[model samples]
Target: MKIACVLLLLLNLQQVRTDLQYDSCGYWTYSKGFGLPEFTERIVLNDVTVYYHDSSLRSKMPCPDWINTTAGKEEWSSIHAWSVHSRYVSALGFQSATKQFNLTGSLSDQNIYQASGCCSLYPDGTYRAFVTHAFNGKDFLSLDFKRKTFVAAVPQAVLYKTLRERDSATIEEIVAYYRTRCLDRLNILKQAPGVLIRKVPEVRIIEQQKVGSITVTCHVTGFYPPVVQMVWLGPDLQPVDEGVTDVLPNEDGTYQTRKSVIVPEEDVGEHTYSCVVLHSSVPDNITRVWGGGKAGGMAVWISLVCIWLLAAGIGLVVWWYRTRDAVI
Candidate 1:
C-alpha cells in the first residue's frame, strides 16, 4: 500500500508538470496589442527545460498538443488570457473581464459556467485583476499574486504612480541593456542653434620680391572667426622665427590675413617657402607656397637684359666704322 501511494504521488506530480508545459513563444505576440514591437520570449518549462520564441511571426497561438495534459492545457489557457489582459492594460491603460456561460444539459438552463478575470502580474509577483459583471461593464478587482489576495480597482492615478516609479527604476537599467547590444543604434545629431565654428582658412604666398632683402608676403583668406597664427614654414616643414601678423576679419564674416618674412640673401636665391595657417579645431597644418623660387630667376633676367643692350651698342659702332672706311 505504501509503495502504491508513492507511485500515485509521483504520477500526480508528473501530470501537473505535463499540464504546465507552456510555450512562451505564444505569449511573445501579446506585445503587439500593447503597441510594442515583436520580440522573442525566453521560456523555462518544469523549471529546467528552456526554449525561445521565433521573432518572425506576428500572431502566434500555443498549440494544444504542446501541453502534455488537460491540466496543462487549462493552465496555459489561463496564462494566455492573463497575458492578453496585461497587454491591454498596459496599452489602453485599462482592462475588463466577463463571466462566460454555455447551456448544454437538458434539465439545466446553464450547464457550463466559468469565472474569468484579466490581470497584470508584475515582476515583483504582485498582480492587478479586473473582474467584470454579468453585463460585462467596467467592474474590476486587483490582486497581489504574491499574497494571493484581492483589492479594489487600480485607479488611473495609482497606475500612473506605479508606472512612474517603475520607469524611473528601469531607465538606467534600460540604458545599460542597450549598451551591451551592438545591434542597437546610437543617433548623434548636430543640434547646435548658431554656428560655432565655420569655414577652414586657406593660405597662399602671393609674391616674393627682392628689395635689398627678400620680402615674402603671404595671403590668407576663407575662414570664419579668423585664425590665430599664420607663420612661414621652413624647408624642413618647421616654423621659423619670422615676423607674423594678427588675423583680420573681412566684412563678409570671413577673414583676410597677411604675414611677411624677411629671408637672408643667401637662402633667398633659390628656396621654397610655405605659409602655414593654424586653427584651433583642425589638427593638420594648412599651407600655401610663394614662388617656385630657385636659382634667382629675377637677377638672371636683369643681367641678361644689360648684356643684350651693351652688345647692340657695340654692333652699331662697328657698322658705322666699316661704312666710313668703304666711303674713303
Candidate 2:
C-alpha cells in the first residue's frame, strides 16, 4: 500500500493550472528524484518572464540580454542564497515525509516530490498567495490564508494536514512570506516597462460526416493569454450541448482550443448552427455559421478532420470568417 501511494503520487505529479486574475505572479517549483535536488524558478510580470533560474545553471542570476537586467546584482545574490537554502529545506521535507509514511521501499523505486507556490497581485490593489504540494504527481495539500489552515486535496493529505496545523508558528511564517514578502517582490519586478501584446484567434468550423449524423468542431487558434470562450448555438442563438477539448498552449505562446457538437445530417439545412467565440483579443464576438446561411468561403488551410472525411468516402464542408463547402 505504501508503495502504491508513492507510485500514484509520481504518476499524478504535474503543474497545477493557475486561476489567478492578474499576471503579477511569481511561480516556484522544486522537484527531486534520488539525486541532487533540482530547483526551477520563474517570475512573470504581465505574463512575461522577468527572471528565471534553475539548478542546472551554475550562476545564480539569469543573464541580462545586454539591456537593463530584471533586478540589481545585490538582489540576485540574495535570491541565490535563499534558493539554495530553500532547496535543502524541500529535500529535507521529502525525507521527513517518506519516514512519516513509513515508505521503506527499495531505493530503485524512483520517487518524486514537488512543492509549488504562487504570489499574485491583482489590478484592484488586492493580492493573493498560495502554496501547494504534490508527491509523485498528485496534489497533496494547499495553504488557505483566509482560513489560516491547510486544505487537503486528497484523502491521503488528511493526516499530513492535521500534523502540520499543530505547528502554528510555522504557519504564521508561511502566511507572512506570502502576504508581505511575496507581494513586495512582485511590486519591484513590475516596475519595468512592459509590452502588452494581443493576438486574435482564427476560428474554423470543421465538419465530419458520419452515417446518420455529422460531427462539427469549432477550432479557435492563435489566441494569447490563454483566455477565450467557444459555444455551439442552434437556431435563435440557443446554446447547444457540446464536448469541449482542453485548452492547449502553442509554441508561439498563443493558445488553441476546440468545442465539438454532433447534429443530424437531415437537420443540416433545416436549422442554423453557428459557433460563437468571445475573447479579450477580439473587439466583438466572432461567429461562424453552418446551414441556412452563407458558409464562410476563404482559402483557409484544410483541417485534418476534413481530410480524414474526404479519405473515408464521407463528405465534408468547411466554413470560415464570412463564407461554405456543401456536404456531398
Alpha carbon lDDT at 15, candidate 2:
11
Worst 10 residues of 2 by lDDT: 314-323
| TM-score against truth, every candidate | 0.29, 0.63
Question: What's the lDDT for residue 309 in model 2?
Answer: 30
Superposed by TM-score, candidate 2 places the C-alpha of residue 72 at a distance from the truth, in angstroms, of: 5.7
Q: Give the CA lDDT, 0 to 100, for residue 124 in model 1.
A: 21
Badly placed stretches (over 4 Å) of model 2 are: 1-57, 62-78, 121-126, 147-174, 180-198, 206-215, 236-238, 280-285, 294-328
For model 1, the stretches where C-alpha displacement exceeds 4 angstroms are: 1-197, 280-283, 295-328
lDDT of 1: 0.39
Q: Indicate the residue-level lDDT of 11 in model 2.
A: 22
lDDT of 2 by residue, 1-328 (tens): 5434322322221111112334554445555555633666666765777777777887766534433444444445555666765566456545555655566756525556567667754322446667888766777777888677989876766776777788788788778777777765665555544524456789998988899998888999997667666666665445676655689988877889999888887776666676766565543456677763333332111222222233222111111211232111
Clashes in predicted model 1: 1
Model 2: lDDT equals: 0.59
